[model samples]
Target chain A: MIRQFGLPEALAILSGVQATILLSLIAFVGGGVVGLAVALMRTSERTWLQRCAGFYIDFFQGTPLLMQLFLVFYGLPVLGYKVNPWIAVAIGFTLHASAFLGEIWRGSIQAVPRGQTEAAYALGLSYASRMRNVVLPQAMRISVAPTVGFMVQLIKGTSLAAIIGFVELSRAAQIIASATYKPLLAYGCAAIVYFVLCFPLSRLSMRLEKRFAVKT
Target chain B: MTYQFDFSVLLPYWEQLLRGCWLTILLSAISISAGLTIGILTALAKRSRFTTARIAAGTYVEIIRNTPFLVQVFFIFFGLPALGISFQPWSAAILALSLNCGAFSAEVIRGGIDAIARGQYEAGTALGLKPLQIFRHIVLKPALRIIFPALSGQFVLTLLTTSIVSSISAEELTSIAQSIDTLTFRSFEIYIVATILYLTMSFGFATLFKLIDRVYFSYPVK
Candidate 1:
């Protein structure tokens, strides 16, 4: 029996894997920054700000990421904003990733010893200085493991970006699969690529979990 | 920047939006309940005395965990049709959601069971309690308590995952919102409103879970 699928098609598909990686990175960095802000706001003293952040996190975290993508990708254009598909996907994912990451990071932040914050305060460090100099460094140790674990999720999440017309790995797989009528092979290859991308991060997360077990 | 928000466009379509919300809730409730049941079975199977049962369940969890749920839904909705399963969008959505939730729930429940002290099981045997009775009275209670937080967290995740059903043309809240957006040409307002409604639902679940935890656990939450 002759094999119909060739290396060239697989190579072409694999070459486009960078788009998925880019989506994941953009979502990771964008989500990380927004998530940190949300985490801080969640712990803020002001009631309204905390409530707002809490609501934002809850909204993104609660609803389906697919729905969020639909709402952002289709919903925004209807509202007269008329943004590009990439921007919509990025925004949708960033918001979705932010909620989960914010909660995770907040857990890490709260896990920091109260005495550390108290000591920093006693030393007359301003709030920003205390957070930057004394608290975040320690919190990062606690945050690293889970944060790395979440990167796997972000990478997988880029698959949703394809729904909004972004030709990422999953979407590209769909395109080639339909053109070639070998879904099992095409999708299988895509999954393997995703697995290959995510497996290393999973291992890294486990390593971090072991190395930083004390902080957590 | 004189963009005034007009919510009045949504007033005429409130009835449809409400129906969509109803569908969303119904779908979520069904998926979560069914997923929880399947999850328990799978969780137990994964840790069963027989290796084959354990491997079968373990494989189910791993495949579901690793693959994208969107792909799983497609396999059911589109792929199953090729095999003449003939599932409606709702049924397919429920199936996918249940499988996804079951995998996650199995892990949570397994963690709960694993966290149990070995001595506790020995003590049950020493008391002449049968395995079923021991599991029912001792293992089930503490495991539920331990896993409740994670289970609730998974439910929240499931709630969001249900939105993917829209891709199959299921008229859930997001689908309805899309229709409403097309009809009214008020995407920002409708989406903003839908966003708030979703937040309300999330808050509602959180509050309900907290109350249930208080009433059910009563003891200290570990």
Candidate 2:
């Protein structure tokens, strides 16, 4: 018996929201940590470190996130390393997010006036102290808006986890769309759900950009 | 812990991969052109004096922007069939990609328009230029040069998003790589080569855009 597209199916698809949010959290939290290190590496004095970090950012930014996910989920198995779908998706999303966030943060770091770093060095402040004290505080101001902007992107990015059969929001919608024979209703709800999730963040980022511009 | 890296296995599938890459280029080129045209219109709409025009354009940009491109693709590819208007995968992919790209470019172009100073418009008006002619000659002419970098970046992004079209079985590079991987079980090697192909495409597109920016918008070296 063919079923009608109804509230029940919409709710069923909506149930996947938790999974979507969870995956975004995993990617953002993990990517933020790794990305900070990458940002530091990119801005480091050592030529080799900066070049390696540059290559990493360029590579990740240049390729599609879909390819990166496939590489982790399918490619790793060929190297005889078994990865669960969760691990694979997390790894893939983290790597992709890190490259972008790293670059964003690197730009923010560079925006901090060189004189501040020089002053810190004159005060016998080491790299960690200089970053922790002088540069990062100012860079944080420059970073907040773009960082929030990237987070909005990161949330939307988790949707591609569906490509790995991870049963996220987009995949869940696809399943219902096929089963209920109502792709319009199902995917329509899916798009609305994403809008609800992303629109506010974009607004907040814009607001933060204005606020930060005045302060900086 | 022994892993034998094999780039040679992919050599045999070069012709197939090349065909896929060509299709990717074709899809991106069509969408970028279509998307930019739509982008320019919507950008003007968003800036229109009519409230309704502003609202409609704003909503269109928001819906497309906030949603994931993958969902947008599936919605058009599968959802429209039920509405009694159906499309082949390629057409559906193109439509969704264009709409998505157009929405983002709308924002870029709107920013470009907003960046133009009020004085420029007044200067044209004082010189007896009509509203339309002032915009065409003074406002948009300068705005395009400023937004070229952002638009080109978006163009490269559209190229990458083309990879997602493979989900609809559009036979792009990623899709071809998928089938080849299954046939050879060289998943790692196949995807690595595919990744490099994509990287090269991105770099090539960026370079082409740089050249275009130079030729079309070259201001006397300031």
Candidate 3:
């Protein structure tokens, strides 16, 4: 028997939004930390470090995130690293986001004019201080729009966590669809919830792009 | 770190893995061709004079762009069946992938079109060109040329996304890898091979895209 999906059912599925949002938050923050380090390495003067970082970025960027998640979830145990689904997804999404964000941040850092860096050097600013004080601030300004834009992609990327058996929004939608056998209602509700979540960020990204475009 | 890696178990399934790679590439190709056609049409509808056409196209793009492809796949597969319009897993996956990527590529194409200046068309009109010829020569070609890099990036991404189709049990690389993992019980080694296959495909496709760019899109300056 096909059950009718009511407000209660929709609400139950919508409840998965928290898990989705939480997963995105963890991935973004975790990815941001790793991305900064990798971006710095990619932009560093050391050839070996640069090549290693480049390889890391290319490896992550080229492969499917689904595979990456699978590898981390299933493959790690072979190497004797214990991994639950949650930890697996955390590592996977963080790694995936870092690769993309590292590329973005590297471009942003390199975008800062050479004159400014040269001026900092002339002023006796050390490498660390130059980046922390003079360079990163400028790069952060250039990066805000792209970074926020990437946040939208990161949120969408979290949906893949469902494949690893995390009960995030996408997975919860499937569960609801199968449970009720009213997939039209269940998946319809899922799409609506995702739209509500992502549309605003997309618009904000466009607006930020426009604003930044004007400034530069 | 003393774990012994048993990659030898994977050698037996080499044919399956190769076939899976071919299937993955085929899926990406089919989706991208259909998706790009849809994108061009959607981009046109979006810029069309009719308000209804514009809004309808706008809504479709926004809805698809904002939602996750996995949810979109579920909706098209399981949800459509509830309404008595079911598709097999492969067809459903291709439909979802094309629609999802179409929305994105529409934006890319639209951006390219909009970047062209009004004066260029005016200049074409003054040169006694028909509207169609002007659009072909002065607008579409250059717009496509400019968006080639963005299009290439999207191509790589669409190729990666084909792996997501494995969730719906499509007979792609990831699904094959999963089957082999269970049979061989050498999950890490199998996945490592699978990852390398994907990396090779990605690089291979990117080089092909670049070649296509140079051959078809590049124009010599006078």
Candidate 4:
């Protein structure tokens, strides 16, 4: 079966590995920044501000990203604004990642000891100063493993973009599978590529867990 | 420049949409139950003393975790047919969703089981209980109690993910919405309604899980 398959066809499917990598990068960085803001808003003192953040997170996280992506990629045109599939995919994935990453980071931030915040307050530091100088610094340590862990989810989630007709690795594999009439080989290679992308992160997450455990 | 929002156009198809929702519900329920069993077994395998068992369990988890559910569905729906195992869209979708949920649930359960104190297991052994009895009565029951919340969380995640099966034409809520969109050209309204439906379903399931947890666990949570 292996010898029967042509190399060029497999290479065609493999080429889209770059798109998968790019999709993950955009979601990771974009979601990271937005997630930090949402996490801050979630912990804010203002009631409405906290509620707004809560709604934002719940709405995005509760519903499926597939629907969200369709609504963006398709719904936007109905609203008189049309963008390319890639932009819609990015927006959809970025919003989805932000909600999850926000919650994860919030847990990490809250996991920091209450004593640390009290100490910062006693030192006459402002709320902003406390978060910037003390709370965030400590939370970063607890956040490493989970954040890296989520990258695996974010990367895998990008495969949903294929539904809207964006040609990512999975989509490319679908195309090749159709052309070559070799669904198993094409998809097997695609799955292997995804594994290659995600396996290292899984190992890194475990290592971080151990490294962080020793300190705590 | 006024476009009046029209929903009456969708009225006639309400029953069809409802049927689709029911399918989605049934698909998710079956996947959740089946996935939970597979997850617990895999989690146990990963933690077993046998190296082959650990590797097999770990490989299943890593493959499922890394790949998208959409791709997995495609592989099963399209690829398996080549290997002479034919599956309808519904069965393939359920299989893929269950596999995906199994991986995540295994990790959550493994965490819960691993968090158990060694003293508890030691006490079970010292009580002259068989290893299998100790596992069933001592290890698993307590582990399920601790991990119930995480397990429910994964179930909700699985519900959200079932939308991907729509791509393979499983006729779930999202697929029904797609047809409605084609007919009425009200993409935003149709999707907005679908989005609300999804949110409501997810919240409803979460609440139901909470009630189940309360009734079954009966451990007053702080």
Clashing pairs in 4: none
Interface RMSD per candidate (angstroms): 3.1, 1.1, 1.2, 1.5
Model 3 segments beyond 4 Å from truth?
A1-4
Worst 10 residues of 2 chain B by lDDT: B213-222
**Model 3 C-alpha lDDT per residue in residues B71-141, reported as the tens digit of each score:** 88888888898778999889998999899889989999999989889999999999999999998888888
DockQ of each: 0.37, 0.81, 0.80, 0.69
**CA RMSD of each candidate after superposition:** 3.4, 1.5, 1.5, 2.5
lDDT values of the candidates?
Answer: 0.81, 0.91, 0.89, 0.88
Winning model by DockQ: 2
Model 4 ranges with Cα > 4 A deviation: A1-5, B1-3, B128-130, B220-222
My TM-score estimates for the predictions, one after another, are: 0.88, 0.97, 0.97, 0.94
Model 2 regions more than 4 Å off: none
lDDT of 3 by residue, A99-128 (tens): 889999999999999999999999999999
RMSD of 2: 1.5
Per-residue alpha-carbon lDDT of candidate 4 for residues B153-204, written as tens digits (9 for 90 to 100): 8999999988889888987898898888898888778888888889999999
- Give one digit per residue, the lDDT tens place, for model 1 in A8-118: 768767976988888888888899999999988887779998899888876777666766776788666656787877788888888888888998888888889999999
* DockQ value of candidate 1: 0.37
| Candidate 1 residue pairs that clash | A63-B160, A64-B160
Best by lDDT: 2
Docking class of 1: acceptable
TM-score of chain B of 3: 0.94
